[model samples]
Target: MKAFFSALSTLTVLPVPRRFHQCDEKSLAASVVYFPVVGLFVGVLLVGLLYFLKAIFPPLVLAAVLLFVLVMLTGALHLDGVADLADGLGAGGAPERMLAVMKESQVGAFGVIALVLVLLLKFSLFFEIIDKGRWLDFVLMTLLSRWAMALAAFLGKYPRVAGTGLAFIGKISLA
Candidate 1:
């Protein structure tokens, strides 16, 4: 009877207990969830804004709105990554030194150029789809781009820090 009660109690509760870390598991999970929500909102908002632009201005205006929306939605986090990674990789140093370069807050020419190109490409591609008069394309692009970001963390090694990135994703699972 006691064993039955114990099993019932375990099954009734949360399966994965919350964990705390320098970066807590719950907080990280929340961030992961939050990004997609923001992306969805951004995607919808951009499409609507583009629709408005199509009425009031040129199609090129849609690209500007989309670029601005991305900056707003990500708080430019991935843009920061692009900048950091560019500088680090472009430094032409050993791995340790390269990682150290990336850790610095200073932005360099390569970083700026990389960020500009990334934003440009995203905006241009998004603009093309929007111009085709398809609203569903916006939602699909948002899902695909965000999923690609999530995969980026999985496919790469933990740069210089331990326990960084989609906290719940395991190396073997990704492999």
Candidate 2:
């Protein structure tokens, strides 16, 4: 379906049906419905990579590689968000100031610290998961996280009137 392809293309770098490449209002709206499906595709790819390298590397290395691959595959979009949010939370005093901080492109000290901690946490958690041979958990967790993103986009308010999220948020089923 156009929706699925659009969703897959938008959510990840993975190739999808050619028709869905040019994203638009309708496609984005439809794509929200397929967010979890996109997550599944991403999860499967990560799982396959893990299995291929499982025997060839140690747990820490594998975890690092996995994290790196995830960042690459998703274009490090989440990291940017986390950094901005952390900076806003730490440095911004008033609500207006927080909004301004989040809007700025440059990352602050709080953002840097937060990213470091998050990366460390991700690496440790991933190391443990791979060590225990819980591949299924990895996939399920990936799926759940993506689903949560979709839910938030659908349910969360878009703070800016004109931004990338504006097209996808508040344009679909909000009930």
Candidate 3:
């Protein structure tokens, strides 16, 4: 469907038809329902990659590769959000000032630190999961994270008058 294709194109670097990339606002908002489906697809790809590479590389190297592939797959969209949020929170002043800081193109110290910490945490978790041979956890992790993103969008208010999240933020419903 258009909604699923829209969600897939928006969430991942994986190629979808160009027409799918240019969706109406309704289709964009409806795409929220398919976020978890996209996540499941991504998870399956990662699991398949892990199985293929498990013997070719050690756990540590494989973990890094998996993380790299995951980042590449999503085009580091969440990581950018994390860094921007860190920069905003780290500024620590009025809401307007924090928003200004976040809107700046350049990353600050807090952004770097946050990115490092997040990547490290993910790397460690991936290492542990691979070392323990818990491959299925990848599916659960990706699925739940995407579901959480949808839930947040459903419940969250869009602070700015207009921004990237306007299409879905506070616009999604359970129905």
The regions of model 2 sitting more than 4 angstroms off are 15-18
Highest lDDT scorer: 3
lDDT of 1 by residue, 1-175 (tens): 2222222222222133233212345444334423344446556766777767777766577667767765665457567878988999999779999888888889998899998898888878767776777767887777666656555545656654453453534332322
Judging by TM-score against the true structure, name the best candidate: 3
Please report, as a residue range, the 10-residue window in candidate 1 with the lowest summed lDDT: 5-14
Each model's lDDT comes to 0.61, 0.84, 0.92
* TM per prediction: 0.69, 0.92, 0.97
Error at 172, model 1, angstroms: 10
Off by over 4 Å in 3: none
What is the model-wide C-alpha lDDT for candidate 2? 0.84
Model 1, which residues run further than 4 Å from truth? 1-23, 30-38, 154-156, 162-175
Query: Between candidates 1 and 2, which one is better according to lDDT?
Result: 2
The residue-by-residue lDDT of candidate 2 on 51-131, one tens digit each, is 999889999899999999988888787888899999999975888799799889999999999999999999998898999
